[model samples]
Target chain A: MTFVIMFLEFFKTGLFAIGGGLATLPFLYDMAAKYPWFNEAILSDMIAISESTPGPIGINMATYAGYHVGSQYFGIPGGIFGAILTTTALVLPSLIVILIIAKFLERFKTNQFVKDAFYGLRPAVTALIAYAGYQVVAESLFRFSTFFETMQIGDLFVWNAIILFIVLMVLSRVFKKIHPAAWIGIAAVVGILLKF
Target chain B: MRLLWDLFFTFFRIGGLTFGGGYAMLPMLQNELVEKRKWTTEEELLDYYAVGQCTPGIIAVNTATFVGQKIKGFWGAVFATAGVVFPSLVIISIIAGFIQNFSHLEWVQHAFAGIRVAVAVLVVNAVLKLWKSGIKDILGIIIFIVTFVVSAVFSLSPVFVVIAAILVGILAGQVKRRTKK
Candidate 1:
């Protein structure tokens, strides 16, 4: 039952997550809120790992989410199964839609409805992704749970996270040639070295 | 059989090597598909990419499917897609299985914390890029602002937000056509 729901959820993500892999972030955020499979902290980790890994970010995230959800319910074997199911579910819609488009490539490309719909969707998808980014930044840099407990101003921020975030953001702009995976690798080493 | 196998291996190589996302995969696709094997011309590949972008789901997967269907029909599309996603399924599953065991470690926790910050930064960078490309006119800006506030402040489902945007977009397009006449 859980696996079935997982498949449906991922299929929906695959169906609607237009634009690219990053576009899928909003859906993943929604899943984190709705399911016990993952949380914001884990979703952050998933994003890091997915971005650094091979293959597409959207598919990697689906597999990762599937594994986490399945493992919690059934164990390692379940995780592997979940990974396959979720990945397939995510890819299934693309396969169907692309095949259909391939047959009518010319007609579809010139269709005004497709163009206009995408025009509106592009901005909305960007906004959705931006919101997802905000949630991630908050999860990483703010001590929300701790703040709730302590109810103090000092307790509300993860100062190290904030500093690192700013530094990395600047470095990313300055060194535009570097791959994101490299920056992530640098951060991991810095984390260990600084005991962050 | 040979062409199907070639299609699968070609995409598998492309998928395993390329990092970041669909755009990052382009130079590689040009090299492998257009330049090396002559499976497609540069123009056709670009068209596939453009169509893939506006379509739902991952762009890379959509491109692979389009190319495969063009080459060897349905089975080609199947194999290519399967090959492309195979590496992710294997690599991520193994990592997922192992990472949970080590997640409780102090050093691992620290590393993840740092990675988390970097992830946020990367996501913000992506949003900026999207903004430049996606937000074009007044309608686009309005849609962006409304979608962001609705989802961010009110915490509405992104699905609803996306659905509403599509409807509004089509309606706006129709309205513009009528006014121009």
Candidate 2:
């Protein structure tokens, strides 16, 4: 049952996540809401792990989610099976789509509608990507209790996140040539050094 | 056999080291895959990137898979996917083991605070690059704005938004055809 559920969830992820890994966030959020297996906090952790690790963020998250849910519901075999199910299901749609697209690429290279549709789809993709970023901010920075608090204009702000955001942005701009890995590495070290 | 192993190891190293996801992997991929190994040309890498974006799956994995397939057929994709995933599986397993405690650490949270901002910037850079590459004309601009506003404001499902855009695009094409006739 867990295997089947994992397969179906990832199949949907593959079929509909048009823009790629980042695009899968919204779906994962929805999944969190729908399934009792994981919650938003775990999803956020998944995002962090997925971002820091290799492979597609979506695949890693799916694998993580499968492992968590399957292990909890069934056992070790269930977790492994769930991971396999999600990975195969997640890539299956792309495999099929790419094969079909590959076959017709030459014929459709100059097709105006195909070109235009893709062109139009680009912005939508951008928007989806932006929304993913925003969701991350909302989750990390804003809290429901803060919202409910006496509408204190000053209390509404999360100064720590905002400050860190500004500092990182400045560092990125100032050290434009430095690889992002360096920054992430530094941050991780800082995390450990500061005992965060 | 060595070549396949090299390919696998190279990608595994890439997958292990890269943080901030696919876009962050771009320069590293170019450096390792194109510059060092000469596995594929720059133009081919760009083409792979484009295809990776349009298709499903993570761009990094899609790219690794495509490159792997190009280099060694089915086994290439298999190896590349494994290479890309191996690091995360190991790291995440370790992290997962200690994550319950790790989350409560103040410095860890602070570091995440900084990392989160970096992630935002990376996403912004990605968005800007995509916008430049993608939005070319008036119709393209309209589609972008419409999609952005609709999704950002209303929080609609991207699948539905994409479907609608395709429908509108096809309709526009048909209208143009009729007018030309």
Please tell me which predicted candidate would have the highest DockQ against the true structure.
Answer: 1
Chain A of candidate 1 gets a TM-score of 0.56
User: Comparing only chain A of model 2 with the true chain A, what is the TM-score?
Assistant: 0.57
Give per-residue lDDT, candidate 1, residue B44.
Answer: 63
Q: Which stretches of candidate 2 lie over 4 Å from their true place?
A: A1-58, A61-93, A137-148, A189-196, B1-76, B95-106, B171-181
lDDT of residue B77 for candidate 2? 68
State each model's CA lDDT, in order.
Answer: 0.80, 0.67
Q: Looking at every candidate separately, what fraction of the true A–B Cα contacts under 8 Å does it contain?
A: 0.77, 0.44
Interface RMSD of each: 6.0, 4.8
Best lDDT among the predictions, by candidate number: 1
Candidate 2 lDDT score at position B166: 68
Candidate 2, residues A14-128, lDDT tens digits: the string is 8888766788889889989998867999888777666545556777777777667666766766666556566667777775665455446446857887765665566555556
lDDT of 2 by residue, B55-147 (tens): 776777777777777677667766776787667665654565346545555665666665555556555554555566556678767877787
